[model samples]
Target: MILVIDNYDSFTFNLVQYLGELRSDIHVVKNDELSFAEVEALHPTHMVISPGPGLPQKAGMSLKLIEHFYQKFPILGVCLGHQAMAMVFGGSLKQAPTLFHGKTSRIYHEGKGILKNVENPFCAMRYHSWIIDHEKPIHSDIETIAYTEDNIPMAIQHKKYFVFGVQFHPESILTPEGKKILKNFLEISYDKAHPLH
Candidate 1:
């Protein structure tokens, strides 16, 4: 089963619907209800940190849950989730020079990992004021894989794990290749769940 931690974003249902289209075994739980024990009880095959409001640092418990469970399965972080991943890994987040809310922006990515089959310079939906600081990567295990035209970290992936984060909301219809990106992540989770098959 796939578990999504809803951070009370307006688009939480959109992500849930998108994942449901990919697989019927998708579940969503509020951020306040998140706990390592509860997550373990559900036995989710994969976990997705949904886009949310406020700073990632404020979601202290959720970050800890990610840190504890990330190594157990393939995890994907979206927007706020991306920032949460960075903070959990020792990276920092700060206000963007310009905040983006419901805007389409061109993202230049190297087509690596989650962006593997995605087209270069893809147009993705942007909706956040905070970004992961690229100048200083506090976590040696994390690597920024994509950036915006202005040089903000657009996408990031773990150096040696099936974990990734996208600053943009891939579940939005506004994103040119949103579904494809989610599909790629679903495949990753499948591979990990059915390893050696």
Candidate 2:
């Protein structure tokens, strides 16, 4: 099962639909409405933090969820969720060099983890005003995996956990390889949940 924490964003359902294509059991709850006890009951194999408005700090339960479940389950954070993951891991956020609402950009990645087998410089949809601050030192545990042409961080993953974040909206129609990205994430989640002996 997969749990999706909706951060009051219009794009949350779009992301859920994309996930549904690859998984049948998915539950979605608003960031503000979810309780830890309920999450404990769901026992999701993977957690997806949906993109939303405002700063990651104000994302309600989403931030707490990342702090609590990052080590327990596979996590995929998108946009605001991405920022929240970075913030929890000693990373900081700053206004992007330019706003990228409903825009597209080229993404260069390390071709590992969720990006494995993905194109090196793929086009992805962007819809964010804030980005992980590259000027400051990122947490040692947080490994940046992808970036834009301007060197803005595009994707990140934890060095020792199954936690991942992406600044781009892989659910958007503008992103051609959106399904592949989500598929890769699901594969990673499956491997973590059922590791080979």
Candidate 3:
């Protein structure tokens, strides 16, 4: 099962739909709809923090919950969720010099990990005003997987944990091969659920 924590993002429904098409078992709830205990009752195999408007620092409750759940389960944070993950894990965020809404940028990434089979310098759909501060010292376990030409962090993953985040929206129509990126994420969760060793 997958638990989607909606942060009132307009794309929340689309994300749920995409996952539902991939897996029959998935649940989506607003960030405040369920308490931590209630979320535990659902037994979600993985969690997805959806994108939303505004700064992640202001999302006090969601950030706290995500911090508590990190490393305990696989998490895929999108946009605002990505920022929230960075902030929760000792990284910092600052307003981008230029806002990116419905814009496409080439994302240079490693050819492995969550971006396996994804093209390097792939065009990705971006929609956020804040970005991860690469200068800040993030947790050692965190590995930056992708970056924009301007040197902004575009994707990240926990080196030893099944946690990942993307600054761009892989579910958006503007992103070519978007579904493939999402499929990679599902595969990660599947591997976690059915580890070979």
Candidate 4:
């Protein structure tokens, strides 16, 4: 089963719809509503942290979930979820030089992990005021995999775990390759969950 942690974002359902294409067992819970013990009972094979308003510090259960399952299962964080993932591992966030809400930007990526087989400089939909600070030193375990034309960190993955984050919203119709990007993540999660398969 795939567990989606909703941060009260309007786009959460859109993300969930994409996930449903690849997996039938998906569950979404509000960030502030679920307890860790309750989450554990669901036995989620993979987790996705949805984008939303506010800072990572105030993301509630989403932050705690990453800290707990980053090593145990695969995680994909988008926008606010992306910020929370970085902050959990010593990365910092700052207000973007230009706020991008319901906008599109070109993303240059290393074509690794979730970005594997994706276009190197694909256009993606963006909607956020803050981003992972590029000027500061990122955590040793976190390897930046993608950046925008403006040099903002757009995607990241943990060095030794199946955790990943993308500043762009793959669920948005504005992103032409949204489904492909999400499909890659589901494949990664499946491979990690069933190593022998």
The C-alpha TM-scores of every prediction are 0.93, 0.95, 0.92, 0.94
Candidate 1 lDDT, 71-125, residue by residue in tens: 7888899999989988889998888999899888999987777788688889999
Model 2 residue 63 lDDT score: 87
Candidate models: Cα lDDT each: 0.85, 0.90, 0.83, 0.88
Stretches of candidate 2 exceeding 4 Å from the true structure: 190-197
Per-residue CA lDDT of model 4 for 1-197, tens digit only, reads 89999999999999999889888999999998998898889988889999999998888788889998887778999999999999889899999999999999999988788888788789999999999987888789798899987789999988778889999999998888789988887777545453311
Superposed model 1: Cα runs more than 4 Å off: 190-197
Estimate candidate 3's alpha-carbon lDDT, on a 0 to 1 scale.
0.83
Which residue pairs overlap in candidate 2's backbone? Answer: none
Q: Which candidate's lDDT is highest?
A: 2
The CA lDDT at 40 in model 2 is 90
> What's the lDDT for candidate 4?
0.88
Residue 32 CA displacement from its true place in model 4, Å:
1.2
Give residue 10's lDDT in candidate 2 (0 to 100): 94
Model 4 CA deviation exceeding 4 Å by range: 190-197
